[model samples]
Target: MQAIVVEQITKSYGAKGAVKALDGISLSVAKGELFGIIGPDGAGKTSLLRILATLILPDAGEAYLQNLHVVRDYKRLRSLLGYMPGRFSLYQDLSVQENLSFFAAVFGTRIEDNYDLIKDIYVQLEPFKNRRAGALSGGMKQKLALCCALIHKPEVLLLDEPGTGVDPVSRKEFWDMLQRLKSWGITILVSTPNMDEAELCDRVALLHNGRILAMDTPAGIRGSYERPLFAVRSDEMYRLIQDLRQWPGAYSCYAFGEYAHLALQQSLQGFDTQADSVMAELQQYLESRHHTGIEVLRAEPGVEDCFIASTKDR
Candidate 1:
């Protein structure tokens, strides 16, 4: 059986249910598979994770973790699930060791019972075992939270934006830890707004406006961009993007790091779109716009590129 299953789940908040958090969203995760829910803020990533964590019930449809229904079998499922919420929710006054011990006791387990499960992580926190959780660095706090969640050796882990507020190096370290945990047969469903992180997941679901825009491996998601893509940069970066967006043949144009990635429409009215001719014409057009230092090169589609195009298409 699949490790996690969600079918046609929906949620809304506010008076008369004016806000729709999820719109018939459905997906599943295989045993030990690392699945990602990728999207920006207000895209319902938190709501979806919360439902799976059994923090709240979905308005319609059903969800199951390890074949235990999220609603009906929440009590049973809780013992098998480890959740690290986006925000730090641990007791501020308690030291790291105290917090870990408290959570283990709550679950009726001793820290030694699952020492092997979290030893790799706790070593880093051991030096600061007496430091209050609230006083720890952002990254340390995340590590402590993760350690608490894993104290019971849950079969499935739900990490909600564990990278947020942490430094880039810490973020990388955290993901590496996750990769290690997956090897131990734990199903992981992590949610993040960082598009770059999507590549690390075995599969990802791109979500926006309370709905899934696309779901596939990172390579598969990039392959969905059927248009010709190019990276263009010039002396006037700001003006270059404006001109590219206004260009007649432009299908999608947006800033990407040092260059603005432009996806061209294959066919444009009275425009010769043959690759060679298109590149030459684009240069000529930018030159005419009084933009100097122009450089345009065909570019491969990245997860971020595909994300923007998908959002526009939807």
Candidate 2:
């Protein structure tokens, strides 16, 4: 069964003329699947998540969780859901154990009652059970928050940017824990700005400016980028992007890390795209512009590259 459903849900703040936070968004998550809503801040991920959690209502359209309407069935919905907001919302003054126990109590359950659901994560926190939540490291705090969210064994889990502000090791560990949780038959819907994190999800809906840019498996989205892409770098990194974009043969040029990932414009009539020919032309153009130490090579496109290309126009 589909665990979560959102259809053409549009939400905006301020006046009617104001920009929307979630523009006609529609998506669904399968049972026991890990789905990600991938976008940067202000992409309306949190707004959509809140709507799905039945914490807030959308301006238009409908949303459902576990076959229950989010607006009409909010009371029972909250009981059947686990939500970890983007920010650390736990009481800072409480100890880890105290916080965990409190959440369990609120759900009408005890920690030991759902011990198996949280064992893997709780053991990691057991050593710091006495530590004040505010005193914990970023990663430890996140783990504790997650444990509390799962303490009730909710059928669906909503994690909003759970990796934000944490150390890299902690981020990796958090995702690892998510993978294990999927096996326990909980539907997981997570949102994040990290491009690499998109690949970890079973499927991702790419959101930009509250709009659904693309929805597909990571590979399916990346595979849609059809063009000869190249990584071009010169002694002047910043100038390289500007110059390449101005190049007659370049279709698109954007900075990716230390190098610029550029797509060269194909000939008007020919179906074949000669990657080497375009590279040779780019090299000559850079050389004429006195660009030294130029390195231009074909690049394997990634999720970020595809995202940029997909959203650049709209």
Q: How does each model score on TM-score?
A: 0.96, 0.96
List all candidate RMSDs to the true structure.
2.2, 1.8
- In the range 69-116, model 2's lDDT, one tens digit per residue, is 999999999999999999999999999999999999999999999899
Write candidate 1's Cα lDDT for 201-256 as tens digits. 99999999789899999999988877888999999899899999999999888889
Evaluate residue 244 in candidate 1 and report its C-alpha lDDT on the 0 to 100 scale: 97
Candidate 1 positional error at 233, Å: 0.8
Backbone collisions counted per model: 0, 0
How far residue 270's Cα lies from its native spot in candidate 2, in Å, is: 8.3
Q: Model 2's lDDT to the true fold?
A: 0.90
C-alpha displacement of 129 in model 2, angstroms? 0.9
Residue 38's C-alpha lDDT in candidate 1? 96
